[model samples]
Target: MRGYPGRFDPLIYYGKLRLNQTIITKRLTPIKVDRGSRSATATLPRIQPRIIGATYLMIALLADIGGTKSQLALMNEQGAFIHRRTVLNHEHPSFDALVDQFLHTQPPPQCAILAVAGPVDDGIRCRMTNLNWLIDGVALQQRLQLKFVNLLNDLQATAWSMTDPGVQSRLGMLRGSGLNFEQPVVVISPGTGLGQACIQPHQDQYVIQGTEGGHKTIAPFNRLSAELILQHWQQYDYPPSWENWFSGSGFSRLFQTMFPGAPVPDNATMGQQAISDPDSSSARCMELFTQAIYAEAGNLVLQYLAWGGVIVAGGIPPKLGKLFCQPEHIAYIERKNEYLDRLSAVPVALCQEADAPLTGAATYCKQRWHESS
Candidate 1:
């Protein structure tokens, strides 16, 4: 990727022209036909990075790691998928083993971006909340012999996915038109865990900030909801969180609390049963679950001051899409006493695309590749 005079240079990777510097950038090669000594010492100028395409070049390793499974892919600077692989987390002893198997026959990527289901420290280290895996980006880069590596919270990766052009078509709008859309949107995902990320749309781009907002104490809208929270607290002797009341485990706990003697089906099955029998206990529980999710999303909108909107995304939303999109439930999301009008005005959409974090990791990688040092 060689840059020309008076043109965009993002595609071209460059190393600084320094005097007697020993540093070497990846994908750089030099050759000399002769013992070529024009002066007292040999000298070199900046070198162009290896290019694969006319404009969109840079290939990178992108990964989306979750509690139950993981997805890895090779993506280009233009956000095109070259190849992807999915693996169960439990099947592999560690992240290193899984990544090694995936990259066995693949070219060593210049950069790697990993989205883990946990809190990342300084975008480098993460201790997975559901799985027993501690990932360190710097350590991974050394082991893989890559030039750069970045780690992101899985939800943050999902937030980044929204930036991909293809994702817009997969979105299902639930509320306001795009007219009121603004900066600082928030994503609320309920699945294996309640994942949240605040996306601040900047000038022609967006920035994602991962948060553990799911662990924040649950806020009830009324006395019945307050009672439900109390019962949830009693189960663990700790205050209930959005994760405790709205995630996969949350649905199970709520169903069990409602029906102690009857069989408790999996969350997916429960959703099916609710759809089949709207008057059953499963339906009541689903109503509670969906309503709780809406409330929490509103709470997040307020917490983050996200006037842009709310994107409800996760494994569960698409499954319960029928119940999730009920217009009657919109009130639950706009119940804020003081900010009711503002909350209602914000656009709300449910992202239907699967494997969002992979696309997001690609978006993050391409951004990093283009904005060179």
Candidate 2:
């Protein structure tokens, strides 16, 4: 079997030995039956040892770490859901505290993959933007008695989870010809911040590349957008980036900018007011948010040439999917592009699944296990 270099040794583990034995025995067992007083024992065919090995390899520890809450799941090799749980990270003092709570309740997994809303390298160290936690993959593995550990940017895992056939049902389609699975896929998610990535096509496989492109300055396509951004630049002492008007916080800031004398509504009131009136100040803020998202999607589509499709995943887009589906939003998206005709050929899909990031983490672990075997 293929192995991860410089990681845990499967042969030296007793739990793996027992798991292997259990799988092998199950494969070899047969049953006896009697039909009309005629009894016969049937011999079950011998199963491939690799198949047993693969089954044993199936079990993995997966976590989807988000800004407010974190989700953990234990999954088998076939991507079957086992045990799932969620914890509020804000209540936990540190990452260790959160991991400790999960370990106390769940069985120790053979291998682990953690998906975090931050950049990751070498599948080890990670720094989350919203939480006061610094995670070390190796340390968590050692403490939890894991064989190997992998880390992925949250959006990268979301892109990976998109490979599952079931994801199609949750996706609300937008303009485009259709999906060409063979081509590279692009992911753009708007939440606390914007997340972008491309699922590059490999021979009979795909690789997701996460990027911090959300931080890139957003070039305003209209005078209104330009004025809104420039206004914030004065206060922030930084350029008005896409994130300023594209995120939840950005929406509030934009509302305050558009109607400075209006009462500063709390988060709840702002959301409620926006829903109440699409033309209200709150609604105007949301309009800009949608526009920024559409603009970014177009930019990424052109940059990646994502003929496969562009997927919108995150808390915001799915809830506002209907609004985004409107003709004005679609037309606004097409208007900003110099190559509108070419870009129009690319399809855009929205992922409605709330726990997509968690599913992606599990899928990532499964793919790694399969490749190793």
Candidate 1 has a TM-score of 0.82
Runs of candidate 2 with Cα error greater than 4 angstroms are: 1-57, 233-237
lDDT by residue (1-373, candidate 2, tens digit) is 2222212222423223334335223233455755667987754333234324334344577889988889988775557766778988888898888777776755457788889988786778898877768989989888877767889999888888887777766677876645666887788888778889898878877888889888899788677888877777787877866776677667666667878878877656766666778877777767667777877887887788777777888778765665777657755556654888766677778787888888888777777876664
Tell me which residue pairs clash in candidate 2. Answer: 58-77
Which predicted model would earn the best TM-score?
A: 2
TM-score of each: 0.82, 0.83
Instruction: Assess each prediction's global lDDT (C-alpha) against the native.
Output: 0.77, 0.73
Which parts of model 1 are misplaced by more than 4 Å? 1-57, 179-181, 232-237, 260-262
Per-residue CA lDDT of model 1 for 223-291, tens digit only, reads 667887777667777787778767887887777766766888887788899889999888988888888
lDDT score at residue 340, model 2, on the 0-100 scale: 80
